[model samples]
Target: MGWLRGDCVGRGSFATVNLAVCSQFTTPTVVKSSDVFSSSSLKNEKQVLDRLGLCPEIIRCFGDDYTTENGEDFYNLFLEYASGGTLFDQLKNHGGRLPESDVRRYIRSIIRGLAYIHDKGFVHCDIKLQNILVLGNGDVKIADFGLAKRTEEKQSMCECRGTPLSMSPESVNDNEYEPPADVWALGCAVVEMVTGKPAWNVKEGSNIFSLMLRIGLGDELPEVPNELSEAGKDFLSKCFVKDPRKRWTAEMLLKHPFVADNTLSSKTSSPRCHFDFPDWVSAGTASVPCSPESVEWSEWKFDSVRWSNCTSPVDRLRQLVTDKKPNWSESDSWCLVSRHQRTV
Candidate 1:
């Protein structure tokens, strides 16, 4: 009955996530954790998904908890499980580039998710291919709200916090940065989508300056293959603009001709179920090997799966299925999932 897969969907400075299956409901879910204290302490992620109003490009948060276990407070969270994995993993596994049209639609999804985040007044500070999740359908979802901050308060530059390669020029130079930075990240992701690697990456033992030379000062934008249509090149040009102020916003990018006029010629497959049981079932708790930094999360502490503000593990969870009030914040769900510890 206990079917959870514990592979890192994504890793932030403070958390890790794994895929899970809620056999009881026959629905796929994700689990995550901060791994500091008890497994019960978690933040539900469903609230974020609900709050964002359903961007198919972003992973949906389903349930979560923040509670005390073993005299320690832990944070656990959960969300929709993506079986297809992340764009980064796909890039490595697919081996050798994506078609320009395919890249366009992928970028469109990235923008749609970002647009939803911006509309909800949040900044997905950590936007990267690793955080871009792919579903059974070709659709993509942005995961990992651990570093996401929901605020209208804008920062003027160096305040950007995340992987540097995808950062905007202003973010890299410590100038005023805003939502536009996300576009830059999207552009980097597009580059990776088409090239099968990061737009800008430093070699082992290389200084930061050298990497910057390839991105900040160099013509890092890959040549739009001669095979690409003019509209595709134009879209990339807009994103690669050096001026952050002039960069496209999520909404603006969505209105681009490449996307607004594009159609999905390749049909999308409907959802298919993925379930394969194991020989061994966990006794009381399913515990997996996690880093000392993650020892707590690697253990199953599911007490705080939901808050009073939401539902409770003690109450008949099935009953809540009748009404629409059953959901949790993204952070909490991650904390909860981290404890289940199933890796497939």
Candidate 2:
């Protein structure tokens, strides 16, 4: 089906995410596009999503296509649009922290998604609040599978695949990204949700190397919020285990009392909130600015003879001045000091 691209909602280092409406659907969808040459990650995401297929807890991918605009080719992947934005957005709306009840609901959904991915022999290398999308009905789904890989795939040494704040001990030390590492990241997300702060106590301007050392070798774990219920704390305990082997798996966490209890309503009764694209400077479409015919390009041009590959200090100083004389203004002239002025 043909789709019309709408406002550009987001831009990453390698891709642009825009709202789109397909001819066959009434609801708007999201189209993530990247230049054909830099689309490997997007293509990988499409393949992984297709392999995992049809899990309600996971984000749905409609399909992908190649399109050309302004003589440039782009690869586009269509995704289910989450009008409610991300879990991080919800946290900002709710005063930086979510109620325990809400946290439980969200965590339950995430665990279910993780369980499914792990069961499929895949590991979601990155799992954080920003990666979780909330639907209009308050249901959350796991999104952004760019870093996902098969569970059996061995990670290269010294390569970190996720945000450092959420990195598990095993991931930090051994570059191992297994299912348990995701659970550790899940624990970080849980703490952030409950306290409205990062799980790790990383101070401003703190050395990242030292932090990694602490995470991998210092035997320190994120402090569980005292405000949390005993069951909630216990649940976090299972996730924060330093040893990956002992860490509770997603399947195991699903049965924990904190999440297993379904008496509490999981759905939000409030109306679905739409994200305001404040960061989007353009409307309808992204366009490149055309040079105005009124401006003279020749006047702005510099003499090619003025530049060179010289690296000496004298050469650098010579390059700073131009052949043309400076147009000095009134302010450029130094004021003469009065004779009455005394030296300080």
Candidate 3:
């Protein structure tokens, strides 16, 4: 049976992702296509995904083909369709920022995928929320390997790769890319998944040079949202270390307390205890639910928070264990800091 193209679902710099129906296939699949003149990236992505083989945390490549329409040869790649769309879309669905439990689960899947990718000798240079697809089962798979390259491949010391927002400090400053570069991007992606904003208070078309400077030379790291637990912040710390050599790998991050701690165990009887909020911690005037939205946070004291004990992963997925930090400045400007808007 011939392929029947459906509505356009997404448009990218190199290709357009479309929902398609192939009479030979039972389940609907997505087709990412680019004209022959501009097909190198698409071809590269397909080859990389094929080399990766089968991975639960990675979108499956279902082969590729080329078609001539109106004299233009269009190359296409068939991929597993994720009905839940991208993690970025999920963030929007939650009105910016997913729940800690959801973030933990998704991050675990991402770490698994990254680990497998690294083990296979490839580096997914592009690892952002938009590049992560979510299945109908709520499981996430890393996608968009257009920028991926073999770990052993050497490039010019000054050639930068990957999305600017998620580029590692080393990649920005020295053009050094390794498995750790993906870890750095993974950290930035986690921040966006939790806070509904890019790691830095910047966008695609803004002063990229200035952003790179802050990422490369400045001492200031992206401001961690007050909503995250000590473990969550520390997890980010491992990813944001200026030295790529010291950055935590996906395998190591999968074992982090932020992802493994079962404080809010679904199987445990004390589900409310997941918040880990002490009775003394409350809204200045009332007892409100301890959520990212409820905290009247103003200035952030990044240096003062104490970390929680990292625990091993249990059968059940865990939620963040938030503790009261005395350093957060109390102010009415809390509303302004709750969510940072972005253009991308």
lDDT of each: 0.54, 0.70, 0.67
State the local distance difference test value for candidate 3: 0.67
TM-score of the candidate numbered 3? 0.75
lDDT of 1 by residue, 82-177 (tens): 788877666656654667677777777888889878888877766777678888887888986544555546543212244545666655444333
Q: Candidate 2 lDDT, tens digit per residue, 1-344?
A: 67788999776546788998778756668999989987766888899999999998999998899999999999999999999988977987887778899999999999999999999989988788878999999999999887788997974442345655688888766678899999999998998888776676644333344456667876577777767776676677777888888777898888777898856333312112231111111112211111111122112211101112334423322333444433222211211122221111
- TM-scores of all models? 0.63, 0.75, 0.75
- Per-residue lDDT for 5 in model 2? 85
> Highest lDDT among the candidates is held by which one?
2
